[model samples]
Target: MGEERRGISRRGLIGGGAALGVGAAAVGFGAGRATAVETERAGAAAAYSLYGAHQPGIVTPVQDRLHFATFDVTTDSRAALVDMLRAWTDAAARMMHGDGAGPSGPTSGDYDAPPDDTGEAIDLPPSRLTLTFGFGASLFDDRFGLSGKRPAALDPLPHFPGDNLRPERSEGDLCVQACADDPQVAVHAIRNLARIGFGTVGMRWSQLGFGKTSTTTRDEATPRNLFGFKDGTMNVKSDDRDALADHVWVGEDADQPWMAGGSYLVARRITMTIETWDRQSLREQERVVGRTKSEGAPLSGGVERDQPDFERAGREGKPLVDPAAHVRIAHPDHNGGVQMLRRGYNFVDGSSDIGRMDAGLFFLAYVVDPATHFVPVQMRLATLDDMQEYVQHTGSGLFAIPPGVRRGEYVGQGLFSA
Candidate 1:
């Protein structure tokens, strides 16, 4: 029931500003325009939010992990809304309260059973695991009764590959994404997904919000989708301000103690198979991610975050991307360390009883150390990359987002009661 704490803080919009809000009102918010009147006002303004590197906790909040709650459940009684979504995908104190484990169940730090009204139990709010899910509209649509009536296929977000949009717009009506490792259990799991109805029932409306990032590993394309090459060409390029503080802010002297007004640490996961990935051959999926099925570039070129030159694409030492590629294990450089920061989102949900599912990405990032920046590029994509054989990390979590809570305080004030 505690909704108005407004927004901002994936380390202050990764240091510049696009999503995360109290309505910053830039509306076409930078990216893809150095100018031409900011590319004719970024086309006209609006369309960048597919959720940019989310965070429900900046870097402190966990009894254990995996906390993401996105909803909008309305059940005048579609048989109590499909038994509340099959008791929210097969219950156990609604996933995680019983400590969810996997078989599609098991991951719960306990969060004080029966819809945590700030109960803080069930454990989770540390580095990050599975709870990854995505669904949009069509609760069988008849508005909500589930039969043969379609109207909830809502998803119009597509324009985040170094975006330069603007043809005139400014959206908001539906968008719910919450990631948590503990910013008070990411606001008690988005207010227990709006008290079990799934969230914002009657609608006070306004959803559009993205977040912090940094990714490249877990394969099948960045651990199951949400922008790990959904046209990946080395993302996050704030152009200047140190690439806008490395894709949007978080360095005022990052030492840690829970860093106060936090910034960094926002890992993610979501892999649903993507048209069974059309079983390879786009040149074996561009030689398992070295780049280019007509432009993801790199095999040592000046695209996708450039600087690539891997001794000019292997320098005849036999490497035009294949020493376990995924862009040479996510940029090995041969010199200048590795780098990350790619805010994200891209999802798909299928009507259940086990029918359609097509999935991938809602992933995120923002770092300082996930063991020297996201576990050595996800331990070379889970041991010797190759897009880790068509991907599968399946939903996970970790949040610690606490920064921007001034107007009389309360948005994890002191990172959720310390």
Candidate 2:
């Protein structure tokens, strides 16, 4: 109902003129085929609702592919920006339901006009797609008169030890994280959204990722990063309501009321020295990660799910889980009981000029507050984690993810409300 109201009556697909409209219709790919929305509602599989108390991607079950993009708002008109968001919201809702970005379908629009939906994902399943959006610190600048509403917690992340941040690939006025079981589907979502934004927003930087490195569901097995070591063994799960409330979801007393049900996102593009790491002995690798490479159990060990025993010592009377081990330093025991919902992905962008694979973990974490939940832990990891030897933080971002939307409401509507 909300989508119908906001979608369907939009005109162009690109350029300045089209950026002013905020509607996109949905359609079935072929004649007689049920629309994806209908098939999903029929229970062909589980589908995540676009309208909710919190966005879907954060806590939704991890998908197989990711297309994460950040954009620079080129328009100075607050009205134009707001309209673009509403358009994005409409497109996102339709796309998540396996419908096209616009109701005209990919080929049914006027012969002379550009098609609203990019036809790439035609006939593809929704693939459990989810689109999560956020606003960067720079968006609060005087450009749109939102200075006072900027949350103090939305401050830029401080530079950390061993950071080799590349300015060209970090930060933006807006961000959209598209994930789906099909890589093409994920890419399609981002492509259409970018197409819809056209002149109003320019793509700043983007990352394509595959093989989710972390999961938000307990039943799913933990996944390994590029280093071949299991990651996020202690991640907060979707069903852990208590943990979600305590660590991931923003509370009622947050500095900005607009972010009450939302969470903060810290994105770090960590590039690993694959060649160097591959040469390390198995024992050394396990020592650096503080877990058995194959099973992911702590060095002090019971099993993968058992709490790490940092105090346990070996025959040499040294801590079995090395003090500098990643698991040891990043453990909640060492970080004042803080935890985050990790939803990272592994990425490989071919090879570097030196002939080494230019790839690593595109780290994404959601927390109630970065100040207490992320910064300190990362600082410790930057200075103390043994994994730092092979990994370098290359690009980074901090975004304020607003709460979800109800039918007929745009994402981040709370921020614009008087």
TM-score of each: 0.33, 0.90
Report how far residue 217 has shifted in candidate 1, in Å: 12
Candidate 1 stretches greater than 4 Å from native: 1-177, 181-188, 196-246, 250-273, 276-278, 281-283, 291-307, 310-340, 343-356, 363-403, 406-408, 411-418
Q: Point out the worst 10-residue segment of candidate 1 by lDDT.
A: 35-44
RMSD vs true structure, all candidates = 18.2, 7.7
lDDT of 1 by residue, 1-418 (tens): 1223333222132224332233434323233322111111121121121111222222111112233443344445545544543343332123222222112211222333332232342333111211222223322235543233211112223322222222221222212344333444434444444454443242222112223222322222322233234343454433433533443334445443333333443334445355545655676676677776554666655554455454444546775666776667666353136455555544454444656454545455554434455555665566776665555554433333323333233222232233
Residue 21, candidate 2: Cα error in Å is 30
Output the lDDT of residue 282, model 2. 98
Count of clashing residue pairs in every prediction: 64, 3
